[model samples]
Target: MGAAQDPNSPVVHLPAGRLRGATEGGVTVFRRVPYAAPPVGGLRWRPAQPRTGWSGTRDATADGPSAPQPYTEGGDPILGGHGSPPFDDDCLTLNLWTPSADDAGRPVLVWIHGGGFVSGSGSLPNYSGEAFARNGDLVVVSINYRIGPLGYLYFGADGAPGAEESGNFWLTDQVAALRWVHDHIAHFGGDPDRITVAGQSGGAVSIAALAGHPDAQGLFRRAILQSPPLGLHIPTPAEYLPRTGAYLRLAGARDVDGLRALSWPQLIEAAQGLFGETTRWGHWPTPFLPVRDGVTLHRHPARTLLYDAAADIDVMVGWTRDEATFGFALDEGYATATRDQVVERIAESFPDRAAEVYGAYEKERAGARPVDVLMDLISDELFRVPCVELAEARAELGRPVWAYEFDFPTPALQGRLAATHCLELPFVFGDFATWSHAPFLSGIDPEVRAGLGHAMHQAWIAFVRTGDPNHPDLPVWERYAAPSRTTLRFDAVTAAVEDPVGVSRRLHHRASP
Candidate 1:
């Protein structure tokens, strides 16, 4: 039995089951497809196993359940509202959108949502694949993987029943999903050979981890890392063992069996309470992050990328102009800090180049408010600098790397927030009207803004299809290099810039991590 659909539906046969999706505006949309078995019960902290195949037709009309997360309200709502209802443990699923079921040679874009690895789902309306599917004629896939303790608990010598892994089980789930894509995307009109793994924030970090993994060597030929945090690579057990043990004990989990036996709500509460006031870091209530387990992740992502482990891969790396505005908005005082405090914090954060770097920003914008200065400094240190460093490192390896800076400030934020973190999502997804206050951001120039979306979306699709992003018809996107250090500036009118935020990069280079 199938849900009622338009007579012109696009039916595709997936390995798990046959699904029927509706065609809207020249694109086929399929939602809520499971890529792996549910990671619940005995499988909670284990590596994802292959999903058991289905025997009958399965409806792919809506989003699958999001991974378990704390219920809250009125903060950055990426996957539904902040107060949305809680979900279950079996949240390993994926959604797909394509131009046609017969267009088997089209490129594939797999998007990993960003919420510092805890919140956010692929089911957000802003992440819908319709526009990308219709405009670029490319296949888009978004997925949900385990998060928090369930996704990233670092197992120790306890070996409690299913506690077999040492690092990120969540990352393992991602690898499993990619493997599923390789095996089944062909049936849904996507070319397995032309896959691009792209993500932002924690998702970006995950992409970086995948890029470094030996198992992920040929899973995707290209990658796009947007705003990856410098500190997000899997940590060593030495760095997190105490915190992990404390969290386990707080959850009333005396052993692996006890931890597994704790209810999901009980686990979330224990993790939240353990994090205390520091939960602003966006998940990590416990010390649950990808650990440096020797097996899955051989080394840290940075070391792997720096050593040319992924040198052959094409990369597009970028950060926004005002990356830290969102962090400040989450807490107003963060933006209202004093100059001395800003410098002190910067020095603390980057002891290597604290004086030299802080001096440059302080001198350049001496009259600026403490919060504004802090904002720029934090943004660069956290996002911009790392992006540039990664690009520079990749360039040094003689790999083709393109760099970009998103400078368009969102109207919804008025002037308080510049092109802050995630502000470019609406433009990238071509859902500004649906996701943003269109009247404030676009005014009446819908057609003009619409053109940029077409161009940007096409550029991404081209990147996914061909390893290189330069389409002859589009603007010539030069590979990033030293000296000139050209970068594409995405805004109302996209153009190339010479060394976007060069001063900040220099300062960060001088500063230590």
Candidate 2:
């Protein structure tokens, strides 16, 4: 084999091909490296397969194509303030940021970007791995996977080929990417044994699923699930069975042969129109999502962890202070709801604990703005409660777990949105300068916030390197226990606090699904 050195830069050669990456701040970066063959055409709706090995060098310059995403008017502002342009099916790719081309066996941090599972790419500027790689002396990776109906629809009918095994194809894509990392990251100077998987929102949910997946065992050593929710977008077999039938009927075929006869675009359009305006979940169709497939996922991720399914893995999980504030921002009516409106919405969203939830928040938030109180209630029920429940469950199972609550308010949105959802991304990735409209990063002293990012980033690296997060010079984080739960409070001055949101967490724990 020829020397792996780029000669022109610091990129190296892999068994599959040669890659040339850009040099920034003394680190060499490679982007959009394919790990599996595109799951298009006949392979559509099937599990991911390994990419055919290539000869000579392949350029790892620009980001790979992003999977098909719905067109939002402004698109994802966080993805460089513009919507993702149209792209093709070849989107299974990964990006790498490293200090050197030679194999140094450095700890690896693989990031899974979060966009509610419907949207997001690993190529976002905020997810850039340069700072974390250079500052922590670690190898950083970001990956892209299938999304929406194409990646998540379930077909369990007997006549359809592979339908019984196709419930979690998107998750299978993630596991395949990890397998690629295990077999190939060494060539990029990363230690596969020390691989740590981290993600937010839907990506975080995927991490939790991987933790419980039997096939995913040993693929990753540690995981960080930020703002993970328990029952987001989970489809039941009944929900999918009818949808599968509809697709078959629309294609004008009696069996699996007829279903496969329809074109990809035709199938996608039929699936998109499955859920009409009168449907329970409004505009969002419920055809495709991770289900209780006995093979890929035995049960709900939270239940799996609670029953000791993930007892051997190390985990850090938590939520933000104002997680639901974003929902209010998207629709102002949510912030200014009346008492009757709040009660009705609560009952509709959470019928089991509607009265108890209303009482708890009513007592705690007396005289507060209706919007603020509603935001807290929804945020807790949807995200915060689910997160703490996972920690409590893991602790019960004798697994090591650490929790946190990001409380610092953002200065960019004025005081309207406190430490809201996705606020932690810029801080974690050290991209405050780019978010000029962000209040927290713009108004606060950069020097003070700089240390918070450094400390949090280092803690992640420490957890990935070893199961324990006892880095020198940082606070000794205690494992979450029953009554006296200790959590890392990330703010201007980060410290450990006992039971940060005790009452709300307890109420939600008792009431959550």
Candidate 3:
């Protein structure tokens, strides 16, 4: 360890202007660096515009406002609430942490936070990038883009001026951020050529979507997707416009102009009302998400991969062992579900193959609780299967891709979380203590924490620097292919396993028709 500069003060220059940053633990961090102009007034629902130049040094040391969102915290034990970041329309800012400001060409990792494409910010404490700057000697970047109605709702078809062409504003915002990095990151000691864009959950979904964008080519050479919900069906506008109309009606708005006139809080309430009406449908209830509008997004990432889209880029993807436990840890009904109840719900979700789906899980985990079986089913349907499906698609295309499963169960919440969604964040970022306050990850064993953290962090660094995750200490992580279906299982001791838990996955395929 070494002495560091005062975290309250440091400065760097950018194409737009000079920025004041903060330094701590030998890593200097620049916060809230605007990558695009504020999407406000006439700019609302439009593609992100270029940031205006600043005259003098701009103070970027403080956290900027988060995009407007309805609150989602439900006071659950395992699921903490997050729609609470300071909100403002000017939320297209990015944060960065570098070991030094000199042009050392350190590998850069840009992070996109996950909040179901509705609520999340780059400035969350759990997303701190100091550890990467300090230990991996990499420049870490996180960004905020438009979200919720302002980011995803499609109203332009109804002749609303900015609504028609605004279906993919969020995706455009991401492209703008990447372009900013390519043009300016070198001045902050990062190698723009070696950038790797990474994210978990919805953010990972966004990365997958970006792979289909023509403009996103060459923005990054590598990608890392953690627990992307690949099977979540995205509804077309015709299928979803009723809810948009409901939101407008809820807000008592005659049109986009009237909708825009409402305050942020009012807009959030209207969106929340629509979510309550639609959440029962089991599709993603958020009003904002990527659309299949042939322009910004050409096709679904899985379909894109089938056609070799982004085949030249290297990808590393994985999911935690029990990804759905976090969602139900706080739901008494789900936590106490009976075998019949589980079967009935699964039937409802996959009406075409309800019995076959239930039979597959019941047969795989005989004598296990119906609730437990259902949990595994939900996890596979939402994350694990998608992880394998994406990897398989990439492998079939002859693209370089590696897949893994994070199996380190948490010691918190009486060990009930069981390696649930987002449990791998601390290990991946190598910042357990910084996230000690997180409801889902608190109280982790120090010994298990350190070993897993070091391994995951190093693997990410190795992948970013050499385009391969293999190193002297890591187990031989083989490139994923269908014939062998070789996969890495990361736990207290990491190892490569052949088709770990393929029974349910195989059953899922058989049942899908």
- Top model number, lDDT: 3
| 1-513 per-residue lDDT for model 1 (tens digits) | 444354456777765677877665667788778888898888888888888877766777777888877776544432225324547788898889988888567888999988766677887666788887777778889988988778877766553445684668888889998998877888888899888898888888888889878777788878888878754445676765666777777888866678888888888887776667334332223235667877787776655565556777788888888887776744566655666776677676667766666667767665767677777877776678878877787776677889988887655544677678876666677766456533225332567567766666667777877776666545677899887788998877788888977787766554222
Runs in model 1 with CA error above 4 Å?
Answer: 1-9, 73-83, 158-162, 231-234, 277-288, 306-309, 350-356, 437-448, 471-475, 510-513
The sequence of per-residue lDDT tens digits that candidate 3 reaches over residues 257-330 is: 88778777887788787777667522234555567666676566545544455778889989888888876754
Model 2 gets an lDDT of 0.72
lDDT (C-alpha, whole model) for all candidates: 0.74, 0.72, 0.79
Q: Judged by TM-score, which candidate is best? A: 3
Superposed Cα RMSD, model 2:
3.9
C-alpha positional error of residue 273 in candidate 1 after TM-score superposition, expressed in Å:
2.2
Model 2, 173-202: lDDT tens digits are: 899998888888888889988888999987
Give the local distance difference test score of model 3. 0.79
> What CA root-mean-square deviation does each model show from the true structure?
3.3, 3.9, 3.1
Determine which window of 10 residues in candidate 2 has minimal summed lDDT.
277-286
Q: What is the lDDT for 219 in model 2?
A: 82
Candidate rank order under lDDT: 3, 1, 2
